[model samples]
Target: MNPIATKYIKLNTAIPGPRAQELLTRKEASVPRGPFTTAPTFVVKADGALLTDIDGNTFIDFAGAIGTMNAGHCPPQVVEALKQQVDQYIHTCFHVMMYEPYVQLAEKLNEITPGNHAKKTFFLNSGAEAVENAIKIARKYTGRKAVISFERGYHGRTLLAMSLTSKIKPYKYQFGPFAPEVYKMSYPYYYRTPEGMGPEQMDEYILQRFQDFFLGDVAPDDVAAVILEPVQGEGGFVVPSKRFVQGVKQICEQHGILLIADEVQTGFGRTGKMFAMEHFDVVPDLVVMSKSIAAGLPISAVTGRAEIMDSPNPGEIGGTYGGSPLGCVAALEVIKMMEEQNLPARGQQIGERTMQAFARFQHRFPQVGDIRGLGAMCALEIVKDKESKEPDKELTAQIVHACNRRGLVILSAGLYSNVIRILAPLVITDEQLEEGLAVLEGVLEELCL
Candidate 1:
């Protein structure tokens, strides 16, 4: 039998204990295998940073729904707002009849997101939809068809977004032909830089390639935009230097191309800032946001310069369920909660504590190859050895599964699938944070040592 009592974790049975096993059987019978799951069991309830499974086992949530719960699960304010909205109305599509909440959210986003310049905001239902629309607006405004995205940056699974994405296997394999005129560029990976290349040199090298790329591959004037994830999320929590980000912005400016910051995974205090682009002091012409925008509600937004956003005619860009009433109300409440609670500052504190723990793990384990992140969006890359630095994809998978079995919910990512990333909620208590990290450390000792 598994342990019955712990401070936060309570395991009354084995991981997929009886109840969860029954659900898993039913799930396998009905659901396709295409959608992957990190944790094996099914949840009965979830709160701030913990999840209680159907089998009565409780686990610390380090994944935070892939960085979607920055304000935490079921935040009271957001929930209350949602309930109030449901009582009033659920869906009165913005296209058919406009609502107060939709306009209110737009005002809040325009004021808080990175710039003081005149901006306009519009809503969609998912990150991919926002990216797709951002591209449409950019192309319509600039009259150019080419788009560039960084290597290992993930936008979403939609055709155009997927074509812009760099991962080839599970995300794009055999699902072609891909959209045309999408290009890939190098993003600075300091830890994995070629032997003897200093960090500054690596940044300069990649920036220089942009010039060469324009000359040899596509003319800059023909490019609509360059979309980037301020800090690469699905490509592992790879954080680029401020210099690198600003350099990319400068190139976009010189070339008359729009800069699109895909903040789907890094926005709403996931990275110790309201928006990750603020960290680099680069104001993107177009910003794509989702994930934590409404505390896991299926809503996305594209905020851009007024002139650029205005290029699209009224009927050309909206969907039937574009901005649901519930989503807008929840998002407005979420933004209010974030400001009142100062969640971004709290995220920075969590990040510092986690990074310190990772540093200690590196001292004790040879397999802990590299640790990198921005704010609370932290990740550790696992390798075969420090010297060789060969990605240990198998070991990474084992560690992740083992952690899950032991009442800690963690996930792995990276181009090589060898990175263990933590996306715990910004509202997670210090005690919950420490307990989760302790479980991770214990697993590392058992697996790596």
Candidate 2:
């Protein structure tokens, strides 16, 4: 008997078709508008890189739940592990009664994350929680009050993370009285750099600005950590040069300030490397991970040097449901799958292919102002024209909606909301990837050309 070939995607109805429309009505009434969604319809089932709506409209998912499903949805081994965990126990909670899976996952993270130093890890419930706790650990470890995060870098939605985040309208707008002592630093944006300034020059300029910032904004001794996303995610897949990242690390080292790599969106093989820091050959003092950590389970972790992580007292840095048994088991399984399949290499391959496709699109359309990425995490900056490079936020929305209606699920990012980002599962098949890109290309042709 021959195995069935994967069809990948099938759209029998309009995106909201009738069933999704009904659910959308209920969602509007029951759910607040605070939580934003890229896809217009709610999904009933997801597998690998495909999401099936209640209306039977199947979409090739390019968003990957905002970079959470690198191992793809409902991976059989992970699912089995989760089931076994359920049968044995579910919610013991790390604080109340410690579990083996929690410790095991911590050990795995310590071993695999980019570092040779002795490391320790603790779990949390979400990426934001991971960021929040990482800051707490850094502050306690350094005995300082100020934390610096880059402009256009996104941490999370919690008060401290929100305060650290760069975007304003949605993530921060009107939400003042924010966490204090958080300073915004200049991050190099090479594409938007002053004409004639090369990448190296831009990096140098930003490093110099960092020095000036320390002199003007806060004392270096008073700073706890410098947090950054290796490749800015919500800031639109902005890939900083390796020199710049290392420079920041150097500054932190010189000042005795911890460098926190916010790997929440870039860790666990979304990037070509297990952690984006690996690409730069710089090991961060502290690493915040979540998103793809547990195959979409609501679990996150802060992994760092043992000494720094130990700074927080036992009772000082944990929550009731911090490391649920399910999350731990799922994370362990996810890690195993990532290693067994070498998903990072797969992500690298995907990135190359997607970038090639994006390059073609850029050549065909003047509105494609920029095509940038670090790995499989790729994005396109939409513009009103080639020369002006004015962000086309409205056109970006049109492309996103059109793609969704045509059986593709994509997302918009960046402070301007004019960038289209691709976070397709690393496990996505070549055919599926080509098909999804084709859909996007068709949408671009219709709208831009």
User: TM-scores of all models?
Assistant: 0.98, 0.98
Query: What TM-score does prediction 1 earn?
Result: 0.98
Once fitted onto the true fold, the runs of candidate 1 whose alpha carbons sit more than 4 angstroms away are 1-5
lDDT (10s digit) by residue, model 2, range 28-119: 99999988887888888889998988887788999899899999989999999988888998887677778899899999999999889999
Model 2 compared with the native: what TM-score? 0.98
Question: RMSD for each model, in Å, please?
Answer: 1.4, 3.2
lDDT measured at residue 393 in model 1 versus the true structure, 0 to 100: 96
Candidate 2 clashing pairs, residues 3+ apart or interchain:
none
Model 1: lDDT of residue 37: 96
| TM-score winner | 1
Of candidate 2, the 10-residue stretch with the lowest lDDT total is 1-10
